[model samples]
Target: MVKHGEEGLGFEIVKAVLNGDIIEPITFQKVKDYCSTSGIQATETHMRVILSNSTKNSHSPTYKNYFERVGKGEYRILSEHRRQEKYFWLNVDATSYEWSFSDLKVGRSQIYSNTNPNGAKRKKETCFKYIQIGDSVVAYETGTTKAITTICIVENKYELDDEIFIEFKKSVDYDLYLALESLKANGDLKDCDILKNHRGTLFELEKKHFDIIRRMLRTLNASGDNEQDLHEKVKQSLADGSDERRARLAKRDSVTPVSYETIVRVFKRNPDVIAEVLMRANGICEECLKPAPFYRKFDGTPYLEVHHRIRLADGGDDTVANTIALCPNCHREMHYG
Candidate 1:
């Protein structure tokens, strides 16, 4: 029964990842949040138990692997209402990356297959194969002629084993393409380097990029005039903080009398206070009442977050009444938003 429950939780996590709602760079707290918002009635303990056991089950791959598979153009989880075989095209300006039957044909045929013995298939059999300039095919894998591509292509062909290796580009959604293009136009492409490198590490970075693009699409889809302004505001907020402010605030408040130096000393002695405070806050999430469990103190404790109801910079008193317990998600919202 326990195993079954864990499996259910694992499935939920996978579902969240596929939906692009899990928040990138899977963390325990993030997973917890996913569970909460997903309306799954599982506790963090249940989540941890299932996740830990799932990790050991051999059937379940690491969270990193899940994102890599999704990001590396290997697999996708389209909405159920969408047609299965039909491809989605992502258009940016004049260039469009699409997941058509032709693209899949190229990817499927370029590599050796059990049915084809010539080591070289006919051109028409690979109707989607096309050659692009200036890139080398690094690797190729075999699959059915129907697999989808989710990433975009930089070039069309790559050199491999002294042969002209054909490169099949990953397909992108229109919104993602425009987002990348916008970043490139603004010299912010480096912010999306992980997505470029196929590293799947973008999960660790702030979700501001993803959120911006998503919001832009939402606005445009709704024909809202404030889309650009909303995008800029979101971008500015993501750039202003490191993930360490919550910790620093916790340390500052841990002192016997709550002096800066004493807070530092207390934090040095007991780093867990941060997590303690957050736990005490019942994981209710200080901001928006959503589950946000990812937080730490300067000392790297896992609980007890320190929150200032009134901003010190705003001339709010530092008294306990003016302070309240908050989770890391709330702490960040307070600082960033």
Candidate 2:
């Protein structure tokens, strides 16, 4: 058992571990290093004392009690508030811990319509033409009635009753409630266009309501953008095999093989044949039909080496019927394999 004075050192070690400086399965040398840095002048005996105390208190029996073992050790710091669950673990030199754990609450207030039971109600029915569901409204007590809360819609129409109901997706704080009361009493509700100008206020509403309004605005403004339709058309064409079918059936039938030396000789002797072949193949490799075969030698100099279909060693003659141009890989694979 470690003495009470040594418990202070143990506390410092715990602090270091929690601060992400020291880790579990910590070696004596590592603890010594931490003590040196922390100005504790710790010894192997002091480390053993602390380890014994920690192990005695540790809930897990498999956990190593002392540093005599050479292999790595694992230890956990159990939360007093939560006995069954370990909050953090110290592995070697890396300690992992949860930052925070707290419950979050989210709720909204209910919308209510205020109407007088004794007083005669307005004869005209409220005709809300431009009123939207997400529109913000002000609620306040009408006249000198301090207790009765009055809800003000965007407009006070002849058809609308004096009492209006505004739906709130979130519980408003005291500051917002006061502001709404001020706006309602000032006759801002008569100006329906003013609600449209208060978009910045609506955007500051609860995240759920803001997202709903933003999506509604997008749906209202979605027009004249056919780029997505054009993309779908191209995607359908590729998926339907039209692009691949056209590329496969293309005129890859007439390419002929001619060596780099033969090409130079032919260019000198019959420039017309070289030009005709280039025009027919459209300046592409006859084997792969890829444009501009700039083959280079080991010295980095471009040397186009034309291949023959039938090698002279195999009793193959030099005729267009048995000749085909090939890249180096295709040429080597043909000869070797």
* Deviation of model 2 at 96, angstroms: 29
Q: Measured by TM-score, how close is model 2 to the native structure?
A: 0.21
Overall local distance difference test of candidate 1: 0.36
lDDT of each: 0.36, 0.34
Name model 2 segments beyond 4 Å from true. 1-7, 18-20, 41-44, 52-231, 234-337
lDDT of 1 at 161: 36
- Per-candidate TM-scores read 0.21, 0.21
Residues 1-337, model 1: lDDT tens digits: 1332355665656555434354323355667666665556776665555344242333335333432222221222223411222111222111112223222422232222112234554333221222222212212111221111233332333223323333334333321112323334433335754335432101222345444444443443453434434334423433434344344545674333332221011112122333334444555655456554554443333332456575443345544445656666665555544
User: What is the Cα-based TM-score of model 1?
Assistant: 0.21
